[model samples]
Structure formats: C-alpha cells, structure tokens
Target: MTADCKGTVRNLDRNEAAGASLQASGQRDQVISFRIEHTDEHGDVTGYSQVELRGEVIYGGLTDGDRVEISGRKGGDGILRPSRAKNLSTDSEIWVSNRPGVKILQGIITVIMLLAFLTAAFFMITGISGGRFP
Candidate 1:
C-alpha cells in the first residue's frame, strides 16, 4: 500500500520576500519557514519535515498548524515520493461554481411546469366538451 506523508513548505522563496528586503535594506531576505508535524499510521511522530517551494509569494502561506494532505509511494531508499500536495485553504475553493447557471436552470424548470399545467387544463376542457366525463 502507498503511504501518505504530510509536510509544509519550510523555506519559501517568493517575490514578496525580495520586495520586503529591497524596501527595508539592500541585503537579501531569508526564505519563509514553516514547522510541520506529521505522524504515521501507528501514531508515531514522523518528526519535522521541511520542503522549500519556490514561487511568487507563496500561494497560501503555511502556518504553524496548517493541515496538509500528501499522497505518494515509499521508495526503496525509505523515502516517500510525494505526488500530490494539498493545502486545506485552497482545496475548498477549488470547486466549480454553479451559481451562474442556477438562474438558467430555474427558468427551464418554470417553463416545463407551465407547459405541463397548460396541457392538463386543455385535456380537462376537451374532455368536458366531448362528454368523455360526466
């Protein structure tokens, strides 16, 4: 079975840090660091794992206790190859918004209901005029 590991970006080199450093002094800035805690299935502490992700102003800054999900397979070197990393914050918002189409769907449903009602009323009137019902 593939084992899943969770960790956070300890060192983040982003544009924001450069800008901050430039605005403050002429010295290069340090990368952002995060402390991540992970555990194994047996409830054993997996120790502190760190990752350095390079980007423009870390998309979602990792906090001290941010929840993360990692999926990967254990390699022969006793290390995990993380194939996927997900942050709780961005994951929730990564969904298709159906709000824009809701009005269109509502209108279609209303038209269908009106047509059904009219058809029923027409059938009742025809039945009454043709003496099909007493």
Candidate 2:
C-alpha cells in the first residue's frame, strides 16, 4: 500500500564521521534517517514519525525545519519507503526508491539464475539417459 506523510524535519542525521569511516571501510550500506515531528492546529506537538532512506538517496538534501511530504509504498514490515519526497521549504524534490536501474539489475540476476538452473537440469537429464552417470 501507499501513503503520504507530511511533517517537519526535526533532525537530520548525516551520520557525520561515523558514516565516513564506514564508507572508507566498504560497509556504508547503512540507512540514513531523519526524525519528523507532527503538530496539531494549536501548534502543540502531537506525534512523531521517521523517514528512513537508503544510503544511495542523494537528490534531495533534508535539513532541520524543512517541511516535507513523502509519498511511497509501505513494505511488509510496515515501513513507509519514500519513492519521492518533496521539501516544501526548499521546493526541492528527490527520489528515494523504485529506481528503474535497480529493477533492471534485479531482473537480470533472476534471468541468469534461471538460465543456470535450466542448463544444469538439461545436462543432468542427458547424462542420466546416456548411462554417463554410473
């Protein structure tokens, strides 16, 4: 399912030096996330939410105090993965997921695995029929 969430960016977590260290060590796939605080009409803090984006998201730079609207589908784990996010304050937009290239890569991997399995099955059948397998 899909959802749209509007809130203020209460904090931006860039991971700072810790992320940099992990990047240098080739283990930088950890997700970077920010906190969002929601308020009621009375300007009273109501609730809070979180938007977690993958490490590859680099289009829209979010900052504290940026009002944002995130639209995306929810995963089985009930996480709202932002396919697109708009920063109302900066008028900037970013795509966080559902990338075409990523989908294509996954398709290619699936095809390769299927082909490998078919080839192995064919060889096994032919060998067994020809008495090649003792």
Candidate 3:
C-alpha cells in the first residue's frame, strides 16, 4: 500500500557520513533515511514516521530540521519504501535542503550582496549613506 508523510527530519536512523546502495555489478547509488514527525492535511503534526528515499531528489536537498513531504509504499515486511520526496518550505525560510550546486539562489545572492556592500561602501566614503555613524 502507498503511504505519505509530511514533517521534519528528526534524525538519521543511525550514524554515518551519508548512505549509498550498490547497483548491478559495482556501481554505487546513495540512499538516505530520515525519521520524521508526520503532519495532517491541515499541517498539524500528527505523529512520527520514517522513510527510505531513493535517488537524488530534484529540488530535494534534504538536511536535518527540514520539513518535507514523502510518497512511497509499505513493503510486506512493514518497511516504508519511499519513491519520491519534496521540500515544503517557502522562499522566506532557510532552505536546509536544495537540489545541489550550493543553491538555486546562490548566484543571485552573490550579486545582491555584492551590490549592497558596494553601495554601502560608496555612500560611506561620500558620507551619503544613512545610518547613525554619519
């Protein structure tokens, strides 16, 4: 049967730098599991749950304390077999997880911070910047 859950990553089921699975022959594939606090449809946290997610989830940058939604199925052995995952935080929130490559906004932020700092420095040198130090 398929199952779904939404919640924060409480912790890794065990200690390891990361996880991986071996493909046919000798190729390696990474696997990660997270214990979570399941939430209801209205967003109220319902209870605890666990999932074993496969693949490098696109837009799925997972980290501890991150809230996520997962979809998968339960095996006959009672283990949760997750096939997909997604992050559910907003733009204003700290994205603990991202697809990869630092973050989607990293480049944008570089330009923004550079411009802000340069503008502030320019105004400071010219005594046109707003603040209490003038």
Please report the candidate that would top TM-score against the real structure. 2
Clashing pairs in 1: none
lDDT-best of 1 and 3: 3
Residues 1-134 of candidate 1 have per-residue lDDT tens digits of 37665654333333334443331223343334343467677867778654333222223334445566655555565444343356764452111121436556777889999999998899886776554566
> Residues 1-134, candidate 2, lDDT per residue (tens digit)?
88788889876776433544343224444355776778898988898776777644356677889998887777776666675789899999866543558657878999999999998899886776554556
For each candidate, what is the lDDT? 0.49, 0.71, 0.61
Worst 10 residues of 1 by lDDT: 91-100
Q: TM-score for candidate 3, please give it.
A: 0.48
Question: Where does candidate 3 have its weakest 10-residue lDDT segment?
Answer: 90-99
Stretches off by above 4 angstroms in model 3 are 13-21, 39-45, 55-59, 90-134
Query: What is the RMSD of candidate 1?
Result: 16.2
- TM-score rank order: 2, 3, 1
For candidate 3, lDDT tens digit of each residue in 1-134? Answer: 88776688877542322445533324343456678887777988788876665443323456777877767787786657665566665322211222346444666788899999998899878787456564
Model 1 misplacement above 4 A: 1-4, 7-30, 70-84, 89-134
